[model samples]
Target chain A: MKELTIGIDIGGTNTKYGIVDRDGNVVFQGSISTAEYEEFRDYFNGLAIALRKATESIPFAHKIIGVGVGAANGNYYKGTIERATNLKWKGIIPLADMFKEEFGIPAIITNDANAAAVGEMVYGAAKGMKDFVVITLGTGLGSGFVCNGILLNGKHGIAGEVGHTSVNPAGRFCNCGKRGCLETYVSATGIKRTVYKLLADHLEPSELRGISFDNLTTKMITESAVRGDVVALAAFEYTGRILGMKLAETVVHTDPEAIFLFGGLSLAGDLIFKPTIKHMEANLMPLFRGKVKVLPSGLQNQAAPIIGASSLVWNYLDNNKTQLQEEVY
Target chain B: MKELTIGIDIGGTNTKYGIVDRDGNVVFQGSISTAEYEEFRDYFNGLAIALRKATESIPFAHKIIGVGVGAANGNYYKGTIERATNLKWKGIIPLADMFKEEFGIPAIITNDANAAAVGEMVYGAAKGMKDFVVITLGTGLGSGFVCNGILLNGKHGIAGEVGHTSVNPAGRFCNCGKRGCLETYVSATGIKRTVYKLLADHLEPSELRGISFDNLTTKMITESAVRGDVVALAAFEYTGRILGMKLAETVVHTDPEAIFLFGGLSLAGDLIFKPTIKHMEANLMPLFRGKVKVLPSGLQNQAAPIIGASSLVWNYLDNNKTQLQEEVY
Candidate 1:
């Protein structure tokens, strides 16, 4: 019988859940609205009931091991959601404790980016890589850095927030109150902003000019580029160039084997990839030029986060052997 | 008998060597002129001969385990010095193999910054730290990053090159042919350059104005600052402010336990430290406030690189057995 674990990716808007096996195969999965509720506990309780109902159909032959959760602002050591100020959740909700109590199995919790990194390590492009960075360019840019096959958890559990780094110090204002962060150029909002800037400078026209800010999406821009819109393509090209240059600078410090691109913005193929590669090469230090490859993520976009969180549990089980020296002494 | 290792720190003008025991004690240590007149092999032969003469007088109680060499441009995996481009070494030289043959022990090699980081981990402030970044702000800015208690050696061995990252995109031209690199704002060269800029920008009279570029040393500037030279103090403050802001961005990524400062520029103390710490706190994400620290390296300036390189070999020996995982059948 294959060992299984429940994998959960808890986002600000939705909570995705899956039953995954050791090999990273998700047998069953579903999602629920996170914003439909008033309290995180109510949503969590509903999730527990849904998981129970889903597993009831499966035979006892499949042994369930543990559960792993990936939240936008989860903490691994404390096993709590550190009061995601954006969410309605009260201060320091012990999600792992609640999950363990409900499921009678161990539960591990980590931030979404970290979980995605683990998933990539276990079942994606970084299968054999010891050093790599998983970059998610979505609504806001997020990153997961793996150095020497181990995730870097800094003193305050805030490692790998690459998006916050200012690529253009005087350029754009970031939501974090910082100016000119990398996310300001590479994310969905970042790209849209860039598109508007390019439109102002160039004589090119795009289908996106008339679209409202609320309706302006990365998908619409990508589609417009596909349909031969110069302004849309220019936006992606400009965004990719900035991202690539910033990545070259990052390589000077972290020196990863590869940088795996994930999320919505990464889907723009040659529009983003070509310019990003070109700019990265132009900006890279000689020794690192042509050494680091930027590629798309290997895991299914929807399933990656959940599987990544699950992989964290698997990794913890594998590495946390309590060191023989600790027992011997 | 305790194990002994020969540690060597090779500089452009001098080479420092020491016999270090298992507990990080330097039993016998000394320096020798590199004597640029000789060929690579001849210089190494002389070095080995001098080392042999020193060991002969110490009554060999512990067998030498290996030799660890730290050079400005050493490559750990290749065990070669790739033409020490910054120095007079104009051709590729296999320093490790040459030392191994002469000393009859395994030889390991790494860049000086990496060695200093290892030194800090083994015998300095980062003794028990699993995550930290060590910055050596000398003629150029050099960095060594440790994550999960292991050095971050990226795909091309140039992982910790934080100095090359652009701090101010429009600031100044860099030695690496880039504009506004972090090194352009924070290194010894950076501070001097800043002083020159300050002198040109303001109608200030200071001891530094008469000093030529070649004669304007960090020591002279720092001494002037201590005696209430506004321009000199302002240069340090500006340098520190830029460094602290950059460090804040780094904290968002690596979340290091502490940042250990090493090399010549670090001696500036509160002149640099106060502004650096203030800017870091001010620009830091709220989550990491009052958590991460920036401190002086505990390893003595002279001993850091050699001991750090030796510590790498020690770590390799200690973890070699446990690092390998058995293949699942």
Candidate 2:
């Protein structure tokens, strides 16, 4: 019998859903605007309707195992969405229970970063590797670390928050109310702040002059660097160096085989990769100096999250064969 | 039928050995000086002879299954001793191969830190935990991280070098050439430095004042603190606070169930533990606040290394049943 699973990626803006096969091929996918706080149950009902309509054309024998939801503050163990600062939801929401009620199959939930790490491991760049770290660079820095072929959930499911670690105690204020975090130097907003600092300190000339903080974006800096803008390019180098140094410290603890970069700002290939690798090498201890590799995510854009969420289902099916068989029997 | 394994803890100055059962019981134990590097083979031969003499008085058919050796700079995968700075050996030594050749049994070698971590998991404070980190605070700081019930040996078998990580870019010059290592503030030498800094800055009459750097050990400071010396107590508090903050970063990354502190500095108990736990809770990210526990090693004194090295043999024997069956068949 053909086996199928549902993968849900709930971002701050849109919630993307896909029906995926065992091979990670998405058969059907759709997107919907995330409901404002008041319409939580009604919004899920709408999602279920859309999903049923999309999968109606598939063969009847193919069985959908369950749904796997990936949200910003989702918890795998709890199957609920924790408080997300940007989301309209002010309290915990039973997302997995609602999904199960709609689909009549077991549901799995994981945080966005954890889902992404699993996605990279099962279908993306980290295939066949036992230890690796996935870093997502967007508004803030998010990381997922896999060690010994297992996703580390820590004791309270808060492991792999690499961004909050203090790299430079006096460096910059972080969104987490900490000082000198790696995210302060490496994230998209972090790069912009660096550009602003450079503009203030040096006598350099480029396109980023006199621009308001809101007007500046990571894309603008990348475009400027591509056009031979010295300040913009230096900003990227500076960002990558600090990130690499932080990575060097992390490697000392986790000792992953490779680190995979994903999400928005990671799109600046050599702009970030070159300097990050250089600084990581310089900062590493003698034992781990030259062995760790940095790679890019194979599942680009929306596919990354969908594939990551699907991987949870695939992994669950594989590891829980006896229980699944017992249920079927 | 009964089974036994020999666990060896090779130090720069002494070599400790024990025959252990599956339940972590030491059947027999002995120690010898390892000062002469060139005569390692001779030393082991004599050591084995002594062990055999001890076992002759026992009542069992004592078949040694394997030998697990823990040294300063050992690698598990390649089973090689990569030039330990403290030991006289200046080149790579295939110590496991030598042991296997002499004993006619499978042998494994790993760094002392990794061994200690394995020890903690199997028979020490971290028992029953799926994830934990063991920090050994001796002359230098050594770390061993366990994730999902397995040791994390990064890409080149050189992960978990947490001591060398820089907390302050301008803090202190580390032996590894890095500035502001965590060890620079938490180790015995680190405490001495803290004392001098406090004395120089505060002009306080400390029992530690006017003492030579070599003479002022962590023991003396702990003793002074026990006697109500303000400066000594302040030094412990300072060191613990720094260690706590560093551990907070560690918790965010690996998310171990608990962190176990072993070795000489941990002997101070409340002097280090009280302040370390208090400060760790203070600096933790809101998500991790009051979640992770920090505690001391259950394996006290010389038993730590013996239990740790024996854990390797037990783990290997448990996992290598196919090989064992093949040999028996």
Candidate 3:
């Protein structure tokens, strides 16, 4: 029978899951509304049933070997999600253990960014690369750094919080109660904030001036910028500049070969990529100048989170096999 | 017979060398004036003669198994010192190859900060700890980071340049042509700059006001601060605050278990340590607030460099031995 792993990505509103083979092919895929279940137990029960139904629908012969999950504030060592502000669950949830109990298989969990990093390493842009970084630019900026082929989870399994790294001490206030966090200026929400700031700062004529703060979206900003709106274009430029500078600081820490940009904000193409690359290069040290590449995620955008989550199982199994071989020898 | 490693620390002004055993003991020590030699060849000749003399003076049974060097801008991968502004040498110098040719032994070279980190891991503060950072504060700030017991050299063997990470975009002009680098506000020179800035900003009556820019020293500031000089005390506070904030940012990226402070400036004890620790704790994320320790180096101030350099050989041998055992089994 063909071996397979179940990969699940838990977001605030929805949960995505897929049965994936070693080659990163999804045999069966499904989704469930996470918000519909108010209690943790109810959510787990629904997820378990959904996973079973999805597995039963797969046509090919397969043995489910393991399960992997990706979520906000997921702790790899503890197999729990702790105090995720966006999630409906209020406290620590033993989601990995719940998955194992339901599927009777080995299971692992890590933060979404780390899952993306592992996915990139296993089957996406970072394949065969020992050192690299993956930056997810969705609602906030999240990062996963890999060095010497091992993911840098640090001591607490929460090492890659690049978004919280302060860029400006006196700049914008972040949700974390800090000033000038990289996330406050670089994410999808950050771009919207920047657009409003530009609208207020610049007196130049622009199409986005009439848009209310509550109604304005990153998509609207991107569209306006593409249509030659000066304020919208400037917002992207400012966002990219901040992101690039922050990345330059990151380079001094781990010295990755490449930094891959992923998620919603990254899809804006050259609007974000061009200025980010330019500012990153401009801020790099003399030894690092022109040495590192800034690229986009190679994984299919829609499937990236699930694929990334699934890679954890493959990684865990590979490590265990190596350890077992070492012990036997 | 005791196995010995030749450890060399090449500084801009002087070169320190010692014969060290696996136990991290210095059997014999000596130094040579780096500035006395006009050419690279001349310096190498002097170093070789000094090393031979130092070895002969050791009245014990020993076999010299390997050699390790720590220098400014040293490259572990290339075994060369490249573009070291502080050094008299203009371009790349194959110092490791030269050492090998002179001693007929395996030789390796890495930058000074990395050397200090290895030193701490093998014999000093980070012994038995897998995840930690060593910040060496002298004329400038230098850092070496270890994750999972392996040093983070990155792709170019020049990662962990924490000193160059910008704390302020428009704060101060750095020698690297960058604006507002952490080193510009936290190092020995940085403290002096801060004192000058404070003197200019606040009209506080103090001894430091009389001292000219060229005449001021970190020692003078420390002595003045200890004697209850307001301007001098404020300088340390400002420096510590900046250092702490930068370290807090570093934690988000690497999530180190502890950060060890080393070098001449660290000797000020509570003057720098108190404020630094206070600010570091205040700025840390909720998850990492009390988890990370900021402490002083465990190595003796004088012997740390040589011991750290010697550790490279031991680490290399241990890794190779493990690899060999795996292959044989």
Candidate 4:
């Protein structure tokens, strides 16, 4: 029988899953209300039922070889989800073991960013590239680093956390209880924060000045910038500059060949990429300048979540024989 | 015959070599003047003659299995020393190949910091730890990052360069044509800079005030700090705080279990370690705080250079069956 793997993306509100073939095709897919289940066991029970029904309904004869999951604060090494802030589940949860029991197959789990990095490596832009970084610029920035063809899970499976790497000690307050984190200036919400700061600083006539902070959206800013709104353009420039500087700083450590921007703020395209590339080059050491590429994530954003989740299992299957035995990462 | 490896450390003024056993014992060693030989080929030939004579003089009839070298701007992947600022070599020089030709053995070469990191992993503090960073604080700063038990050579073999990562865009002029590099505030010279700045800022009488910039040394500052000199104490504190803050930032990237401080400045002990640990913890993310250890190198400072260079060969021989084949580093 043709083999397929299941990819499950667990978010705060919605939990999405997909049955995917080795070629990145989604054979079947579905979503469930995560917040409605309340209990952790109930949530998995409902998911398993839905997945089972979906598998039975598929027209093609195929076997699910494994399962992969992506969630906030997921630990690849320990296979536990530790105190995920967005999820109602409190404390450390044994998500991976639960996944294996429910699926009756080998299952792997890691943080969404790491999953995205694997997805890029398996079936997207970073194919055949061992050294690259995936930066997810969503509500909060997330990062996954791939060094020498292995995901950098670190000693405690918490190594690739560039989002929390503070850009400024006294710049801005972040939700993670840290001051001036990179995400505070570079995420989708980070761009919005910059827009408001620009608005408050300048009485310059602009479309964004009319919108209140609550109603202000990154989409509106993008649209405004596309239409040549000075404030919106400046916001993108400021955000890119901050991101570029951090990328330059991070480059010296990980030394990735390419850095993929993969979320809502990234949709701004050249508006974000141009200034970020400019500042990053300006700040980089002489040896690294003109060498590193800042590119868009190859995976389509709408399907990226489930695709990333499933790629973990595929990666596990591919490298399990050698990587698992030798590296222990 | 018993197996052994030769380790060579190439400096601007002197070239040091050691015939070391697998257990970190130096059975024979010697030094030659590097600058006296105007040509690179002649220098290697002269050094090879000295090594051969030293090998014959040794009482034990051990066979040299391989050679490892450490130098400024050494590239591990390419096996070349490229445009080293301190050395007279004008461009990329194939040091490893030359070593192999001269010694009739397999050879390896890496930057001094990376060699030191491998030395720690093979015979020093990080013997069993898979993830660690070694920061060398001498005339300038140097760094080697080992993530997931493999040295991060990056895409271009220049990845582990935390010393050049700018702490401030406008802080201080670095010899590398960069501004505000971490080395400017954390090396032996960095402490001296801090001392002079403190003396200039404070009217408080200092023993250092009478000394010229060229006359004052890090040893005098260390002695003064030991004797409870306020200005000297303040300089160490300032230096440590800067180093600590950079360490906190760096920890998020490679996520080392321990960071070993080596070379001249690291000799100051608690004067550097205490404030560095304090500021690093303070600036760290909630997860990493109190988790990372800042320690001194396990090797004696005087012998560390030769030992670090030589350990590369032993590490190669030990892991050649597995690590070198798989990782290709």
Model 1 per-residue lDDT tens digits across residues A233-262: 888889999999888877777888899888
Q: List candidate 4 segments past 4 Å from native.
A: A35-39, A59-61, A322-329, B35-39, B322-329
Model 3 alpha-carbon drift over 4 Å, by segment: A59-61, A210-215, A322-329, B59-61, B209-215, B322-329
Q: Clashes in model 2: which pairs?
A: A119-A308, A252-B160
**CA lDDT scores, all candidates in order:** 0.81, 0.82, 0.87, 0.85
TM-score (chain B) for candidate 4 is: 0.93
Model 2, span B1-329: residue lDDT tens:
57777788888778898888888998888888888646656776777786677556555765777788888778888888887755776678888777667667778788888899998888887878988999988767889888877888776676788888876777987877678888888887898899888888997778888788878888898899999898999999999999998898888897778999998889999999998999887777666787888888988777678778978877766668788445433
Please give the lDDT score at residue B261 for candidate 2.
93
lDDT of 1 at B197: 95
B1-329 per-residue lDDT for model 1 (tens digits): 55777888888778888888777877788888875636776678778887897677565575777788878778877888876635565667888778767766778788888888888887788989988989987778888888888887776666787887777556798766667888888988899999999999999788888999888998998999999999999999999999998898778878898998897889888888899999999888667789888998888566776687777777666667344111100
lDDT per residue, candidate 3, B1-329, as tens digits? 77788899988889999999899998888899998888999999999999899889765677787888988788888899988866888889998788767777778799889999999999897899988999988877889999878988898888888988988778798877788888899888899999988988998899998899999988899999999999999998888888888899899898889999998778788889888988887877666788888899998568789999999888877868765234223
lDDT string for model 4 (A9-76, tens) is 88778999988889999888889998898788898889989989988966566677777888878888
Q: Write the per-residue lDDT of candidate 2 for residues A154-217, one digit (tens) a residue.
A: 7666678888887666779876666788888888889999999999899989788957899999
DockQ of each candidate relative to the true complex: 0.69, 0.72, 0.75, 0.74
By summed lDDT, which 10 consecutive residues of candidate 4 chain A come out lowest?
A320-329
Q: How large is the C-alpha RMSD of every model relative to the true structure?
A: 3.7, 2.4, 2.8, 3.0
TM-score of 2: 0.94
Model 1 chain A poorest ten-residue lDDT run:
A320-329
